[model samples]
Structures are given as C-alpha cells and as structure tokens.
Target: MRDLVRQGWTITAEETAALSPYIRAHITRFGAYATDVPGIEPEAFDPALDEIDFTVLDLAA
Candidate 1:
C-alpha cells in the first residue's frame, strides 16, 4: 500500500529479498502490513498476484 511504500517497505518478496539485512530486519520489526487498515485500498489488478476474492476465499476455498 501507499503507506508502506512511503515508509520504504517493498511490496513484493523479490524486492524485499534484495534489501539489506538491516533494512529487512527494520521492516520486520516496524512495518505496517495489513490488508484492511481503516482506509487503505488493496489492488486486484493482476489475476496472478493481486486478484483476491476475499468473500469466497475467506469463506472457504
């Protein structure tokens, strides 16, 4: 999300892996990663990555 981006956290595993151990540990300690954080909107732009059928998925996949 934009909040995390603004705080310098990578949104993907690849980018996260490229980060230094210090930075990565900082993120793990203090990063804000939540699917629903009051007002931030989640993207479903990609079927492979971002597409989330929350209702169906949450119910029982």
Candidate 2:
C-alpha cells in the first residue's frame, strides 16, 4: 500500500463511489483493511486490472 502511494496512486471519488457499497457490505463485515490506492481514477483502474499478470505457483507439486 505504501508502495502504491509512492507510485502516485490515489483513490478517486468515482472509485470510492463504485467500491464503497460493496466494500462496506462485504469487506467491512470481515474486518477493516486498506483499500485506498491513490492516483488513478475508476475507469483507469478497470483497464489497469486487465493488464496485471499473476504468476501461478504449483504449491501441490
């Protein structure tokens, strides 16, 4: 999270609006966690989500 802040990411008003309800209902129910990612807007965040590549680890192997 700190790294994201250093990278210039900020949670936008639109992103807050889009995520607030779900976050409140689901995430908060579990416990508090930081969801703030500064610098990018909601629209930008959606496209950025697609660009992420996750490396799969075969833990069972």
> What does the lDDT come to for candidate 1?
0.68
**1-60 per-residue lDDT for model 1 (tens digits):** 579999997699787677775544335676667766768666666656555556576557
Residue by residue across 1-61, what tens digits does model 2's lDDT show? 4677789999667866775434444355766755786665555334455555555445535
lDDT of each: 0.68, 0.60
Inter-residue clash pairs, candidate 1: none
Model 2 TM-score relative to the real fold: 0.22
User: For every model in order, what is the number of clashing pairs?
Assistant: 0, 5
Worst 10 residues of 2 by lDDT: 19-28
RMSD, every candidate, angstroms: 17.9, 21.4
TM match of model 1 to true structure:
0.21
